[model samples]
Target: MSSTLLAPVLEREEYIEQAYFFRTLAERLREGVPAQMALLQIRDELLTTTRLPWAVEFLATELKHSGQLGSGMKRLIHYFTPFQAFVMTKAEEEGVRFSLDHALKVLEGEARYRSENPTPAGLFVYEFEVLARCQLGYQNGLDCMEQDSFFDEDWRQFIETVRRSMSEVEFADLIYLYSEQYIQDQQRAGREGPFPRPLFGLKEGRIAKASHGRDPLYLFAALQRQLGYPEVPRLRLPTEQRGVLQMLEHKVRELELRLRLLEGEVRGQVEVIQALGKPETAESSLEWLKRLDNEE
Candidate 1:
């Protein structure tokens, strides 16, 4: 086989080992083992194993095969890959630090992709690919909770802040998207007693009646408007709203600043004109200026 082809397979082998380690820890955690202990075990495994660089190479290879590597993944590889690497290889100039929890989260996220779309014999491979990324991010001290983006620091903070600030209705919507029956029970209980303040307040009889027979999209739209959020597109994903809101807030601030600047410029021009002399008539003055400019 060509070294180009054999290279990925070699990387896959390293990923397989790391994936096994992560899965072992995950199983122990599920069985009520202390997180510290599990982490120690993971750390011990890392210490005794081949160098981390080799492990990372394996992961990059596996990610290539899984197609989970999107533009975000490419950017990540570009910053870290090496010469003759199937992906870009640049030296790791900047250092990153991350908690073990962050590493686990990244691993779990990748593992989830496998569960969401299963394939035979490839299960372990998928897990390994994800663990490799988690390891890379951990080494880099990057926050794995955030989605990959060009602006790492800003985007990470934005995602975490948005997740924390999610309204009860938005939280419920998220839960509903993932689990319908659980949300229904929560709604029913809210209506019956101690009516918890829901973000959407759909528990209110009047609101429900008004929203009756509406589709989820329409209901969500009304809720968004009521909550003073911008009108979102009907087909947009729920997870996408936080990023959208951040962009909107950025744009709104920019526009506000521009408006203030324009107002100041206009005021300065008006002061200059007033200093010159009171216009014979505001309309006539404007007309005269236009005529003068046209003549020039």
Candidate 2:
């Protein structure tokens, strides 16, 4: 990763404000506020002393011109992490199932974690969980994680190694091998050669060992449950929201049927015209209704 591409580690207050900004923006979006409007509104809510307000202003300007928040964020690499920009970019992509609200919530959780005294190991787990759970491409996701200034050189090297051979290696084994417990066991067995520095603690190693050969999500769950690591947010619409979406889908299907009927009428299909037009006989009208139902 290029040094210039990586944003410097931000202050605790900056992260605090960022968490607030993301959380507020996501909430507003869920409530149906426009993105540009949300940014303008959030700009005034940020601390005047922090650089976030200026970034918000620029984002608003960019949103007006290009109608995309990710484009603006990508240009502000000096302020936002590459991972943040990448998440927003994915959210805004056409045909991607990921929602912008979910992306903001992800960033909000990350910033909130950063505001606290977060350990490098915990931060790495949280980030990796996001990539895994969201099905974000591991290649770019690991690259972004590696470039984050919050992690040191050792962490970057390990992350790059994971990116290269993630498909070949078992995730649990990877964690266990780099853990202190592994080193202790090796020393007890009288192994002679030097070992790489341990990135995970003994407890993490034990969890990984227990979770071996299982789904990696199990390992992530154990870490969050036992070690107080930050949990990645899952995107699920509420019951009411899902119902509304179903209703809209039904309405769209109805519209499509009507459009098809119109096209058939234009082409002078006798059955389509009879289905759409009033019939002279009640029996004919019943037959038309039956045909329409069958088409539906």
Candidate 3:
């Protein structure tokens, strides 16, 4: 993919923090730590951090897209950068491989990808592609981890000691670095957005009244049904909906004018027919008789 497209994917800090978090959790789990405790720690860390909650929201979406949380988490770790990859245990590696293999099989069978065979492969291919990229990143991180210790201590061991040894402030800074690096990597990959665009569904216009008579609040509520609201405060409705209503009114007026024109034409035709049936005056009657004699 072009660097531009990859920039958005890689630029988000949350993706990086997630990689770090997953790597840490996977390592602890492999070493026999309770999964529930690991998850609780991760959640706690995110809540205590300023930027982490927003980042989690994005990660959650990616996870859902890669098929539920379990599959998504596996894919996330597998896709980490080379340095990030070293944190995964053998089991995590195996999970990633399985997900990747399944995805490739699905792709091979897809009609869009196959030359001789066609099937309604559905849109699952998109998910497969996304997961594949995540797995690739994790493989890269693994390669990096094998070369040298990226951090002062073994990352797996560090995670195991995190609760007892690291203070909230220290942990926050580490998380921040990890998040920054992840976002930077994504930026390097050309996965970040063009930036400065209003967040999705936050345009400055009023909800158009023509949209099923939905007010801005109602339209926003409808949007919430599809994409949950962002962490940001609620947005007010714009005046654009009024413009839409005005346009609809104009169309109605045009139709009424056309109807009047049609009615007038029909009325003129009736008037001509009624005049033709009227009895002729004496002068007109004499003229008609003269015209008949001339024809004879």
Candidate 4:
């Protein structure tokens, strides 16, 4: 656990700049730029007064050596949240499909949300979705999220419950049980135990209840639809890549076509070479080969 987890230390403006820094860094990274270079470039783009410039400058230096932005972020615990660092660290793990670009987008959206009036439920759902959708460790993700300063003791306790019961329980039911609607239902039934304060509103409870027995993703979608919470960005699912043999064959064919066109151009034979790309026949192939041999 981080020392700053008990209290938020950074200003709202800092988070705003962090969002910009991450968004710009991610964009530059997609352009095939190295992580250190991307951080250096984005560091210059940040406002002079914001701590982000200093932070990213440090990140650039750290990335220059370690090549891991998450490590840099973790070192700056006073500025960046643990969840932000967790996302990046998870993205950096080997054999994981999560990329630095996707991790940046996730942090960018969450920072923008935190800069505004973020609710406990909203942040929880957003962070949880980041873990669930990205296939990060659920227990570790929830542990990181639970330490956020925005959540109270009740929220922390509930997150622990989620950590314990996650493998055995439905996420929607978890929310529904802790919500206002559940408290109301208990009251209506004349149950008299001390109830914890509601972490979720009546609407959220109803939505979670309605989402019972369904895919848990729909619960997150419903919350995003109704509450305007930030949605986690997902890595693009990998499409079938071309096989090595297929690529080699395609390259060979391309080289042959280019060679034919070049030979035709040298001999001032434009029409015949231009038609070489069209459907090939044995006769046309022979004619093209003969023409190429003439140039030789």
Query: Highest TM-score among the candidates is held by which one?
Result: 2
TM-score of each: 0.21, 0.81, 0.21, 0.79
Q: What is the alpha-carbon lDDT of model 1 when measured against the actual structure?
A: 0.37
Clashes of each: 7, 0, 25, 0
Model 3 has how many clashing residue pairs?
A: 25
> Which 10-residue window of candidate 1 scores lowest in summed lDDT?
1-10
**Residues 199-231 of candidate 4: C-alpha lDDT, one tens digit per residue:** 898999989899999988888888888877678
Q: Write the per-residue lDDT of candidate 1 for residues 4-113, one digit (tens) a residue.
A: 11111123334444445555654676567765455455555563444433444444454456532222233333322211121111112125343333343444433333
User: Candidate 2: where is the Cα deviation over 4 Å?
Assistant: 2-4, 239-296
lDDT of 3 by residue, 1-296 (tens): 10111111132344445535544554555457655555556666663443444434444565455523334323343233222222222224554543322322222222122222211111111222222334434233323333322222343333333334333324222322333333444578888754322211222121212223333344344333443321112222325657677677766655554454365456664344343332244324334334433533
Candidate 4: 10-residue stretch with minimal lDDT: 235-244
RMSD of each: 20.3, 6.3, 26.0, 6.9
Cα error of candidate 3 at position 135, Å: 13
In angstroms, how far off is 25's CA in candidate 1? 7.7
